[model samples]
Target: MKTAICYYSRHHGNTRKVLEAMAGEGDIDLIDVTTRQVVRLEAYDCIGFASGIYGFEFHKGVVSFARQYLPEGKPVFFVYTYGGARGNGAKTMEALAREKGCLVLGEFSCKGYDTFGPFKLVGGLSKGHPDAQDLEDARRFYRDLVKRFSGGAQA
Candidate 1:
């Protein structure tokens, strides 16, 4: 299946690192919403949203991008990175995808090296994250996603 991973990874590149692991395994299109102005999700069978958790949610750019471009009835999954443990980080994206008639496939979240705001004074939270194990886990998640979405089979 043709897959596209649209992400915002500027804070510490935690999500990007995981995406690289997936790319190394296969040919998947990667879209950096930080730079790209337009994304064509209609051409892909599955879409993956990746971002560093910001203010308890996805980066605003990604939210806007998906609201404007995600194709209807497509299968969608999420990949997220955060300074804290996962909670409802994917909730916003999931809701939006569902509103647009996309099937919610699942999500992957891992801690990332973060020193944002107050944490900067003490260095950071989740330091040295998106580590080897985290990447490996992400690879496994990607593999499962591929198996689940292969050949354009609907969910």
Candidate 2:
């Protein structure tokens, strides 16, 4: 499958680590939203939108990308990293994807080191996160997602 992962990873780059690990597992194209603007989504069989959660939501850039460029009738998945365990950003993204006529395949997320805003005051929540274990879990999640999406087709 021609798959692409378009992501925005700032701050501690925890989200990027997950995507990188996933990239090694498949022939997935990686696009950093900070550097490249996604103009067309139809070029890929599947697309994965990833980002770090901010203010209990997806980064503004990620939301904007989904709203503006997520093509219709394509399969899409979400990957995110958050500080707090509780949040509905991924669900909200899923809803948006459905509204856009995209198939919701699956999602992957984990608790990354929190160094944003208020979390910085207390030395962050789950400090030193997106650690080795988190990366491994992300790798597993990515592998499962790929398998499910491929229907056991060759990677």
Candidate 3:
């Protein structure tokens, strides 16, 4: 399948690390949303929305791109990295994907290094995150997601 992941990873490039592993497994396109505002998602069989969680939400660059460019009837999934060990971090993106009439292919989230705001003074939370194990898990998540959605173009 032709897959594409549009992401915004700042701070430690934690999210990017996981995505890099996922892309290594196959012909996956990794597009940094922070640098590119628009994407041609229609050409992909699967579209992945990814980002580093800030304030318990996905980065605004990713959110904005999804709202404006996500194609209808396509299969969409999410992958996010968060500082905290909780929350369903992909809801906003999921909701928008659904609103655009796309098939929800599910999500995968992992802990990422964070030092935004006060944490910077105290070093950071999830300091060595997107660690070896995290990257492996992310690779598995992507593999499984593609398998689960393998039979259908839309849900």
Model 2 per-residue lDDT tens digits across residues 1-155:
67888889988988898899888877789887777553677898888999888777777788778887888878888999999864776877888888988888888888888867777898888787778888888788777877887784322
Pairwise lDDT winner, candidates 2 and 3? 3
Can you write out model 1's per-residue Cα lDDT over 56-124, one digit (the tens) per residue?
899888998899889889899999999975656999999999899899888989999988889999999
Q: What is the C-alpha lDDT of each candidate?
A: 0.87, 0.82, 0.84
Name the weakest run of 10 consecutive residues (lDDT summed) in model 3: 146-155
lDDT of 3 by residue, 76-122 (tens): 88999988654658989988987888888888788888888888889
Q: After superposition, how far is residue 3 of candidate 3 from its true place, in Å?
A: 0.5
Question: Could you give me the TM-score of model 1 versus the true structure?
Answer: 0.93
Candidate 1: list runs displaced more than 4 Å. 151-153
What number of clashing residue pairs does each candidate have, in the order they appear?
0, 0, 0
Q: Tell me the TM-score of each prediction against the true structure.
A: 0.93, 0.89, 0.92
- Estimate the overall C-alpha local distance difference test score of candidate 3: 0.84
Candidate ranking under TM-score, highest first, comes to 1, 3, 2
State the lDDT at 78 in candidate 2: 92
The candidate scoring highest on lDDT is 1
- Which residue pairs clash within candidate 3? none
Segments of candidate 3 deviating more than 4 angstroms: 85-88, 152-154
